[model samples]
Target: MHIAPLSPDDPSELGGYELLGRIGQGGMGQVYLGESPGGEPAAVKVIKPSIVDSETRLRFAQEVEILKTIWGARIAALLDADPEADPPWLATEYVEGLDLSRHVASHGPLDALLTASLGATLAEALATVHKQGLLHRDLKPANVLLGPNGPKVIDFGLAVFAESSVSLTAANTVVGTPSCMPPEQANGEKPLTPAVDVYALGAVLLFASTGHAPYRADNIHLLFHQVVDASIAPDLSGAPEELVPLLTAMLAHRPQDRPALDDVIRRCRALIEARGLKVAQARRRLTNFTAAPAHVLDDLLAVDRPATPGSTARARAGAADVPPGQGESEPEMLAPEAAQQEPGGFRPDRQEPEPPHTPPMPPAPVPRPTDPRLLFARIDTPTPPPAGTTTDEAAVKPDRSRPSARPAPRGGTGTGGGSSAPRRSLRHSAQARITAQRLREAYAANSPF
Candidate 1:
């Protein structure tokens, strides 16, 4: 199926699912390609705004409840639904294949054995549906999907529980495709049985074999008239002789005359076995022959990661963050000043290569002196005095009159080449003060002393 891009009027999200594209549209609403929270693909059917009234909502909710009871591989299982939502919608597993109608239209009719196998599979699927006390009121070629596994029935828009009392359609109003409808349904009969689906299946098989419905009319009225007429027989000229008897019985005018679903399956399997084709072999052939085109299946399974609207354009324009290893080239780290000058925080410039055979540069020398007193004096005054000033005046001016109690240096000489204790004491006091000041600065700066 052709999945068209989502239109401006279509919502980007319903519930929590991100609607990817519009897969198809029907009388009730549009079917969109959506992704679940866990990233699984789903077909989300949104009810039309015109049908969001109380009656339709109730019908849709009932359909959801009926679908919950159904469980089988042949049918597209309902994964989620929100009936109370504005324009209520339901989600189902997205089958990656084309509908049976489109498949047969594109590829010619199936052979006798393949047709029998197809009939058996559909019969079993309908049997499962009937077992759940549910009637797929709308069973047609469009509702049958051809996937990798085999044929799968989809779209329960008109499905109803057999025991339910609600009647969504008006009295004497007909639903479902006319050509595929049984005489009772065509005549607007109530309380439809499972046999009606068997009749429709026969019509579907007829279409598959002959490339057209058993009864075809240009207008709905004429189609309904032809379908309601019991005297008219379905044209099965193109159907295989082996399938003709079964197909005729299935399309019998009277619902009671139509063979039961179990009987239909038995007869189909017998036909396949008589043709020397195992049931499994025939199914494989049917699946292979009626499979959707490779490109179509690829499109259905090709899931793109969900992104916000306009994210694609932003990613293409390099406005979004590029994942680590996806960049064209690794970025080079720059100096603090250089990095600040760039547009973004990181620098985009590449580093230059060094010259060959060059000697490595030596590390810079430390500025600290061996003597603690000289280091303290440097710390006290980072800047030097005038160039012509004497060492005493430039460095430190001590009061010589004050006497020092401490001993002199080990060599019996002070730092300034004097033996005076007072000058030494003053130097020691200045050093002690400088050390204390340095420790306080380090503590305030949160740095190691």
Candidate 2:
């Protein structure tokens, strides 16, 4: 796996584990390379702040519980998690090797014997997950890590308890990669069983042996249709001759038609033995063939490089965007008594840095007043009286811009200037109307002119 430099926005420490760099990021959250206080390596996955709604939190908590119950040699083990953390995060054993997708893309497809070993190893892992009443809903080449031992499956973000009555996704929304998705899942089939994973394993093996999935389409919709169509069989064109029958059965359109996980494991083991190597020996061979050199990973991580100023700016900027009432508290240093914590392992040594204060967004600045002459020019423009109103009537109307024409100054009410008052009022009213009209026109045209 390529270790990418952490961005300014990424948290340096989560749940007490010091995050070294980012491993990968997606719509859900980011995965980082972390080191525990005792120096154990971990892959920490933290949920994104934007998606930390109630439902997403519940799902994340469920994933933590599920991971706790799962234990197998062919899967990355969960090390720590905090569902109630600011954004919530979980850490797993950091498998130090390239993923299946990258391995194949760089070095080419594996031979039939190695492909069988991969299938057998992953099939066993799925079997363990199924025993715990959960389903790894999303299994693809990218999720499998080729460590020193064997192929280990990772990323259980899409896993769900296999309850027939429960719906895993929202209405009309299906998850999982299209290329590796089984027909039942693509169709939103109910009561999803273990066979879905079996089908995915077949696709992974096919990719290993042929460097492509059974079905291919440029559009996601077309791919879904092909996966769901019973008539459109998977294309096993370049697959090894010995593995075609197993793959075809595994890729069957109907879930019930797919082979059981135990059967799949048996077939893969049989294939390995037929090639004159025990399953154990073949697994070791697969690892040796695909393991990346240590120097490559060290360079990718840039372990000795110091943090740059740009990264700190990014961190501060991200902290400023955090909303009130959702501020993250600094993690506390581990105490001797807290060493054996359960749900989330490891105590933090230092408090998380206080997020930089964010000033309230100022109201959009009002447009600065233009030249005073321009304002007078708009007001001076002539305006016609309203329809059906005589010019005299319009002039007599009240002019709010100036004091009301007083009651002839309470004495000598001989209509002094009274005749001129109406004309003055009319001019003011007309100017007001003209000014309003011009402003409306300016606004409609999206300019101050």
Candidate 1 Cα outliers beyond 4 Å, as residue runs: 163-166, 293-449
- TM-score of every candidate relative to the true structure: 0.65, 0.66
Question: What does candidate 1's lDDT look like per residue over 362-418, in tens digits?
Answer: 223335443334433443333454557554563454223322222222211111222
Q: Local distance difference test, per candidate? A: 0.66, 0.67
- What pairs collide in candidate 1? none
Question: For model 2, how does the per-residue alpha-carbon lDDT over 1-449 read when each residue is reduced to its tens digit?
Answer: 55556778888899889887777888898898888898788999999999898888988998898899888988899999999999899999988767888777755678788888888889999999999898998899999998756689998888888885465458878888999999888887777888889899899999988989989999988998898998999999899899999999999887889999999989999998997878987776666456532322233333332111111111221232334223222221111111112122211111132221222221232232243334333223124345686544544452234322111111111112121111112222222444456556656666645
Q: Which candidate is the best by lDDT?
A: 2
10 residues in a row with least lDDT, candidate 1: 305-314
Model 2, clash count?
A: 5
Error of 2 at 119 (Å): 0.9
How far is each candidate from the true structure, as Cα RMSD in Å? 28.8, 28.3
Q: How big is the RMSD of model 2?
A: 28.3
